[model samples]
Every structure is written in C-alpha cells, then in structure tokens.
Target: MENTTETTKLLVSDRCDVCGAQAYMRVQLAGGELLFCAHHGNANKAKLEPITLEWHDQSSDLNQA
Candidate 1:
C-alpha cells in the first residue's frame, strides 16, 4: 500500500490491542481492525503491513514538541 497518513485523530478511548496503552496506529486487516500504541505498532509492522488494507498512523503525534 502507498505510504499515507490518516488525518483523523485517534480517540483516547482507543487502547492498544497488545498492551492497553493509548493507541496511535490503526491497522485494518481482512479479519478486523487492530489498534496499537507506537511501540507495539512498530514491533509488529513487518508482519502486519503485508496484510494491512489501511494503515492509519498517528505515531508522529507523539513527537510534536
């Protein structure tokens, strides 16, 4: 998939599927959507990217300083 950033902000209620931290990335797969915090997202990117239909990433928001 083409590299693109999603504009919509992720809600605070969106928790990481792996660790329950605030999510900054959303991976849409054929099975369903998975919300992930920056750490887990990067950790799983290689495996997930091949199957992800849409990768809505806002991890950069964490560096807005």
Candidate 2:
C-alpha cells in the first residue's frame, strides 16, 4: 500500500474563525477544522494543541517578500 497525503494551501480568501483576519494556520480537530490568524493561533496553541489532530501553519509566509 502506498501512503499519500494531499496538501492544501491556505488561500487569501480564508479568514480567521475568531477575528476575521487572514488565516495563517489551520487547526484540525476530530469534529472539524478551524482557521486562525497568527495572533489567535499562537494564543490558543497551548489550549488547542492537545486536542488538535493536525496543525497546518503558514505564518512563515508572512515573512516572505
């Protein structure tokens, strides 16, 4: 069996579930997924990481020119 993973990039249209800012991270929980901006993502990391199944962070893209 071959293991394959599909990666999806966060689009500019994706907004944070909290403040509506541009989303830079995607947090996947068993129930569903949450989109977060850098601020909320960092702030909630401690509380959410434990329950998150997948954390797709693209905050580094902010540093790119």
Candidate 3:
C-alpha cells in the first residue's frame, strides 16, 4: 500500500475486516491494510500497534454530534 498522511482519511463505505461494520480505523502493516470499527480497533490495538506501520484512526469522529 502507498504511504498516507493523517489527512488521508477513510470514507463511510470502508468496512471493518473483523465484522463488516463501518471502519473508523486503518492499521497499515508492511504487507497490507486492516480496517476496523471503533470497538475492534480498541480491542486489537495492543497486538496490532507494535507491528503497525501507520495507524490511521478516526474513531474520535464517533464522539461528534
């Protein structure tokens, strides 16, 4: 996958790899990308964070009205 910045955000159509829920976080590894919703993102953060190349998180948007 290409390198992306914080501005390179995910669209609403992006789906989580774990449960097909709307994806709000993208975990980029050397091989590929892994998408996750807020719940799964938080759940797998510990394991994924160490090996992650880039963690594009947008779960903060969930708090907005």
The per-prediction tally of clashing pairs is 0, 0, 0
- Please list the residue runs of candidate 1 whose C-alpha ends up more than 4 Å from where it truly belongs after superposition: 1-8
Pairing residues by index, what is the TM-score of model 1? 0.83
From the highest TM-score down, the ranking of the candidates is: 2, 3, 1
1-65: candidate 3 lDDT, tens digit per residue: 76655456887899999999999999999999999999999999999888999898999888983
Using lDDT as the yardstick, the better of models 1 and 3 is 3
Top-down lDDT ranking: 2, 3, 1
lDDT of 1 at 33: 93
- Candidate 3 local lDDT, residue 39: 97
Which regions of candidate 2 are displaced past 4 Å? 1-6
Give the RMSD in angstroms, all C-alphas superposed, for model 2. 2.7
* Candidate 1 lDDT by residue in tens digits, 1-65: 75344344688899999999999999989999999999999999999999999888888889983
State TM-scores per candidate: 0.83, 0.87, 0.85
Which candidate number has the best TM-score? 2
lDDT of 1 at 24: 94
lDDT of 1: 0.89
